[model samples]
Target chain A: MPDVLAEALEQVQREVDGAFDAFLPVPEDTRARLVEAMRYSVIGGGKRVRPLLVCATAQLFGVTRQAAVNAGCAVEAIHAYSLIHDDLPCMDDDEMRHGKPTLHKAYDEATAVLAGDCLHALAFDILTMSDTSNDPFVRAELVAALSRASGHEGMAGGQMMDIVSDEQEYDLQQVTRLQQLKTGALLAASVEMGAILGRVPPEGRTHLRAYARDIGLAFQIADDLLDVEGDEEKAGKALRKDEGQGKQTFVTLMGRDAARAQAEILVEQAGQHLASHGADATLLVELARFIVKRDH
Target chain B: MPDVLAEALEQVQREVDGAFDAFLPVPEDTRARLVEAMRYSVIGGGKRVRPLLVCATAQLFGVTRQAAVNAGCAVEAIHAYSLIHDDLPCMDDDEMRHGKPTLHKAYDEATAVLAGDCLHALAFDILTMSDTSNDPFVRAELVAALSRASGHEGMAGGQMMDIVSDEQEYDLQQVTRLQQLKTGALLAASVEMGAILGRVPPEGRTHLRAYARDIGLAFQIADDLLDVEGDEEKAGKALRKDEGQGKQTFVTLMGRDAARAQAEILVEQAGQHLASHGADATLLVELARFIVKRDH
Candidate 1:
């Protein structure tokens, strides 16, 4: 990773962790368990790639770092909640994540479900707070962008496609559509929300949107590659389940070398979209390159 | 039920159903099933009491019916999603809702989880749209109110308390606190959101807040009463499960007669709080009474 991008990632991880720590103070009552479960998954873990994306994009428009981080936390909350629900027995049934037992495995299934829900609500709650943006329009737009990316037509819809992937023989086109909704949408939203917080009008966001789109697809392609070739310890969770389940993936559909080459080329294209921003876009450009390079 | 309240309920029910039907158009692809499950739970069933609360409160401030109905649909979406998740096997584990198979039973657990999530996201999506309110502050406030009410410190916290109720010996105060978070918060938000949409300043909302608080408690007491004595067919789901699980409730702690009387007293007080609005508050006053009177 470039020094600038790595430093930004580390800074965001600490900031997000601190924010969640302050946001979720475990109550004295039994509700403590629910908040604890939420804290467990949200406070730490993951690469903090999404928050970095938000911060990097926000920096281009001179948005305040605090405001950008707050919006980034909202995106992170949605991501965490999706992971919690996705790991449930009825879903992927994963036993581990981020080198720890999944929420359901650590806590009970009921607590996991409720914690996931609380986090989901927390996403909007964080966005609407004045701390995120003093301007109500910014806050409202942030809420709209995140909700659209994560809702039925976005992340959840993509998840449903994934759940049924084994039952249906999805081709490359179908898989691309699924990944676009499942993973691509939220990644794109992270960049969009940052621009919204910066008061960037919809028309001015084309380059940023293009950058997000290319990276989102490359991120998934890299994920597919990781599933087949990455070490379990490095990934911090189960991998290769796609192949074991005989689910069609980018790597399964395209040859291994071709899939790897596609991710690199997409990363290259993603960086080009940020060329308009020049040096100010250095972190974002580096981040896109990191997407395909990261083992996890 | 009073004629005014009955008419309002019927109107809000139809409006909310129509809004959801419009909001969730089943897609042609695999996502069709996810949207289908959401539609099944949201498009019909339930009392529509929450939506009516929003409409009645908005009426006091001369908010447009279309705007009020749209906001009401947002609240109803949150309510519907909660019910879908609450009925999941890991949670309440019921088999029926609105006289039909629960989402999980009608669909599956994974679909139920995703559909509930989609509806949760849909609530914010609806609020952010211009149809709810052209003013971005109103839209942001609506998001803030609904999210805070439905989040960990509110609805989800209450749900956690309820799940752990069987293991703990909860007293009347504890039960009240639990119900306040679980059921009362959303009900309170319904009224609060209506006031928000009408641009009612926070200080000026004292009486409306009082009305909402009173009725919120009353609603839960009546729910406890129904759980103990209401018919399954009329209630449209399982009943008497609180007693079966040896859980402490209003009916259990206060004695059925005292609980019934307390609910009636709350309803009376709730109406009195709306006295400032006089004839304009007729539907709200009647709605309070209906809370305790309804069989379901």
Candidate 2:
């Protein structure tokens, strides 16, 4: 990873950890179990990439670091819930995440499902309650954007399509549409949320969204590449599971060389979008490159 | 049922149905499936008790019926999601609800789960999107209240307690605590949401909450009684399943006679709270009676 990108990741991880630490106050009854489940699911450990994107996007729009922290944490909450539910027996049926038994394996499936549900709700609650955003309109916009991105038309819809599309042939456009809704929606929302907080102009918002869309696609391509070549332990999952499941992937549609070429193009495009915003986005450009080149 | 309560129930059903029909747009892709699941889960079934309370509470505060419609719909959405998830294999494991095969049985479990999750998210999305309330603070309050009621400290937490308690003996206080959190939280939220929309004074909010809490407990008591005396076909579920499962219930904790007596007292208290709001709450008082006296 580039030094700047690595530093941003470290900073995001630290902030996310701190933010989550303050959540789920110990209820007088069942304090231990509830807290443990929350901690286990969140502290289970991952790349913290979503939170990093949220923070980086916010920073790109000249928002204070604190202004973006809760939004960053909220995205992490959504990400964690998706992982938990996805690992359930009726879903992906995975027993492990981040090299540890998933929440259901650690707790019971019922508790894991409830935990995920609670976490999903909590994400919105946290976002709505953020103290940093003084403008109610800004807060409302942030909530609306995130809710849409997380709801049926975005992430959930993409997952449904994925489930229905398994083992089916699809062209690059279809694949791009799926990846944009599934992965890019939230990433784009993160940037938009930051821009909203910074009160960025409409032109800046458009550029930020373009930047997010290109980087989001590049990130997915890199993920596909990693699954084909990355270490299983570091990836915290079975490598090539998508291939095993006969799922469509960027590399499957485009040859590895072509996929790599496309990713480079997207990174360059994202950087160009950032360039108009001046030096403030220098690190964001580096982060985009790092995201498309990382092994895990 | 009292004539007024019967009329209120019919009105609430029509209002809720209309609200849902207006709010859920048919997305082009998953329009059929989404509408099917939504209609199956929502229309032509189940008591409209929660929505009625929302409408009634708003009436008590002299808010226009149109202002409370979205809040009413939001509560029903949460209620539907709870029923769907509760019937999952890992949760209550029930196959029936409202006299029909549960969502999971009607659809597949994964679809049911996703539908429930989507509905849960959709409720808040509706609240955030609702233009009925011009005050942003009121909107935020409604969102926060609903989130708390649904999250770990409320409905889901109460569910966790229920799974843990099972057949274990608990004192009356503990049982009441469980019921309050599990069933009462959302019921209370329904009433509170109306107040939020109406922008009721703090004192009025307290009285409205008391009215809801009493009716909520009475509603649960009536449900327990239905399990004991209900016809299998009419209830649309297997009667006595609660008894068969050795679950802790109001009927189990207190004898049927005592439980019935408690229901009467709760109804009276709810009526008393409504009295302060005058004849405008006449229908609400009758609704409370209907809650305790209903067969199914």
Candidate 3:
């Protein structure tokens, strides 16, 4: 990781953690099991890559760091909730994530389900709260953008596509659509949310959105790459499930060398969208490259 | 049912259904099965009680019927999503609702999960859309109220407490708290959302909230009473779930006559809260009385 970018991300992660801790109900609450599961899933693990994107994109328009952090927390909470749901027995049924037992495995299935629901609700709670923005318009935009990215036409829809993968044959176009919905939507929304918070007009945000799209696609390609060749300990979960499930992926469909080439091209293209911002977009440029290169 | 409330709620139900049908992603979408499940759950059935709450309360302040309809759709979607999740194999594991197979029973588990998620997202989507409210502040307020009512410390928390019920012994207070979180929160929020839509000030809305709280508890007590005495055909879903699960309920703890009397008292108190509003609150009062008397 580049020193400046890594340092910035590390700081953002801490701030995001503080926000989660502050907002989440503790284990002593009436629904202690659900709260415990929620806290466990969100408190101290995973790279806050989505939150960093929000912060970096907001910085381009000189928005307040606090505003960016609050929005970032909302996105991360949604991401965390999705992961918990995805890891459920009826879904991916993964036993581990972030180097620990997944929420369902660590607790019970019912508790995991409710915790995921709680975390999902918490995301909107964060967006609409007073701390997110002084302007209710900003809060409304965040809620709208965030829900669009996570809803039926976005992450949830993509996940359904993924679930049908084993039973249905998917061509590259289909796979691309799946990846775009499942993963790219939230990532793109993260950047879009930052733009919204910074008071950027809708049309004014085309380039930033383009940058997010490229990197979002590139991020998935990188995950596919990691699934093929990464270390399990570093990755902190089961690897090569795509291959085992016989699912179509960037590497499998495009071949390893071509897939690697495509990701590099995307990463480079992602940076160009930030060109007009010059030095203000440096962290974003670095982050885009990092997405395709990070081992986990 | 009273003539005014019965007619009003019947019209509100149609409007709410239209909003849901208009907003939901169709079966032709990529994850068509999940969409199908969602449509099956939300399109045709249920009493639409929550939506009625929003509409009736909004009427108290003369808010637009369209605005109330939109908010009603939002709350009903959340309620639908909760029912879907609760009916999952790991949760209540129920086979039927609204006289039909549950989502998981009608479809598959994964599809049910994704459908539940899609419905949850749609609730927020409804709030943020311009058709719901022209004012962004009102939209933000709706999102916050809806989420707080449904989230960890609210509906989700109540669900968690419910899951622990079979495993642990609980007294009346604990049971009441569980019922409040699981069921009362959303019912209360339905009334609250209507007030927010009408731009009713927070301080001015306490009596309306009292009205809702009273009815929310009454609603649950009615359900318990129905479980013990209502006909299976009229109720649609299986009766006697509390006895089957060995779950303690108002009827189990308070006994049948006492529980019935409590529901009646609550319904009366609920009407009393609306005395200041006179005839404008007639529908809410009628609805409260209807809760204990409805067959389903």
Candidate 4:
């Protein structure tokens, strides 16, 4: 199962990197700089979770793997931009991301900021420019979906909630709702984009969304768990920064043991969603486990 | 003619502000803050040159005025974001904009930077979401045109070039090319978006592009001329900061007298484009005169 997930991840990464590298505008100096910032933030590091979800969900409907690649690239671009901005001085204020200096720390803050902005715009640009999509309506739908996921109702809004609610206690339901918007929206978008490409049935779309939502929550919980007990070096940054910042995490709200148990249950539920889809979702099931069970 | 232009400008302000106010998202405090940054940068009082151009061009082809309002807002959003980012510490490092502290100064640098990014994305959001344009293909074209205008080949790329070439002795041609991509690209996009909304003829689009390009250069040159002899209070900025920074402008590359002469010629050429369009271009002709002759 782990081998299948690994193979899917590798394929998604190769295709996404190649497609992005090919599509980036060329020969202009400033464009080169923009592209470099994009490349620095995206290539050769971090788990390709979003892109893998796109590929796996498409495969569940027997869609051609090629069909998910562009959508995968689009989601990754959004994810990359989020990470870059999240690490900025005003946002998360982290110096290192994925074991290296954040883009702002590596380059200047303005470049990091502009690079993130360009990448966000470029995600929409790539979706709109996709020749393979064929249907303008589908393309428009994809653009609208991704924009909603990135905008006020989704990631940005969620980040704001997180900032305002830092160090504050909240009930499980409130915490869950916040995580659903912040982390789950994009994860949900990844699966939906793949389903859109696969032309999945409405029922299947609903099931897959639930699956994504569960796994997304589990992923965040697992991250909080890791921060509590994981190695600082292996975790890529200081392991206890969240607690240091008084950020409310699953571990903070619930005990470490309860959070771990909850994450395991969520992962099981995610697997059950894929079970009905059979061998088509074998990689997806493995991904769910890996997402919650991985050390780093 | 000037009275007509003034009335149109007044109408545009009311409509644009109303549309923007209505479309703003709710319930998300951070997103609202981002929107506030956008509204601050956009609605806070500057010459609405780009939005005016978009509206005037749409009017020239008998498009409904409401159709122009959304595009006007979108163009202003892009323009506002550019100003916010340009005034950042890493960019121009300006402390003031529109007689107020720059966005970075008003907010923190990171929020200001993120605000600019969000505003740029929001521009496309507004464009695609506009109800006036029912055609997806037309919306796609508008997105593409604006992206090209704002992306590496457009304003942002032009800005990078300007930053790199600052204080260097560039000739008049180089300066013109830089300004065209930076200032002129958005100006051209405004006109093109108007043409698309109006569903204008190909020849009409060409003429509008030509007119916009000329006016764009003339606009920059007039700015250079103003910087040489303008009032600081009215301009809302130090009068000679461009010269003080050793930046290359039309006045710096060519003599001030020559720059003024060139602006007049470009304005005349721009008016000639309007002439070819006949009575339809009456408002645009007046706009050209106002742009060249305005103090701020």
- Candidate maximizing lDDT: 1
Model 2, first chain, TM-score of 0.95
Model 4 chain A TM-score equals: 0.94
Indicate which candidate wins on DockQ: 1
Tell me how far the alpha carbon of residue B164 in candidate 4 is from the true structure, in angstroms, after superposition: 1.7
* Collision pairs in model 2: B99-B236
lDDT tens per residue, model 4, B10-90: 878777777767766444443456667666776646767777888888887787777778888888888888888788777
Model 1 whole-model lDDT (C-alpha atoms): 0.93
The true-versus-predicted C-alpha distance at residue B6 of model 2, in Å, is: 2.5
Those runs of model 2 whose alpha carbons end farther than 4 Å from true positions after fitting are A130-132, A201-204, B30-35
Between 3 and 4, whose TM-score is larger? 3
For candidate 3, what is the TM-score? 0.98
Docking class of 3: high
lDDT of each: 0.93, 0.80, 0.90, 0.79
Better of 2 and 3 by DockQ: 3
The local lDDT score (0 to 100) that residue A153 gets in candidate 3 is: 88
Q: Specify the poorest-scoring 10-residue window by lDDT in model 1 chain A.
A: A1-10
List, residue by residue over A1-296, the lDDT tens digit for candidate 4.
Answer: 47777788788778887887776746454346666777788777678899898888877677666657877788888888888888887777888778988998888776786777667767777777756376666666677678778775677667656765764566777777778878888999998988887776567687888899899899889888998888877767657877888777899888999999999999999989877788778888899999988888
List model 1's recovered fraction of native interface contacts, to 2 decimals: 0.93
Residues B31-73 of candidate 2: C-alpha lDDT, one tens digit per residue:
3464467668877777888888888878766777876877788
Model 2: per-residue lDDT, tens digit, A1-296? 76777888888888778778787665767535655787788863877877777777788667778769888777788878888887888878887788888898899888888888888878877877757476766666666777788777777667666666664576788888888877888888877777877887667588888989999899989988888888988877767788898888899889789999999999999999877768778777887888887766
Sort by lDDT, best first.
Answer: 1, 3, 2, 4
Evaluation by DockQ, superior candidate among 1 and 2? 1
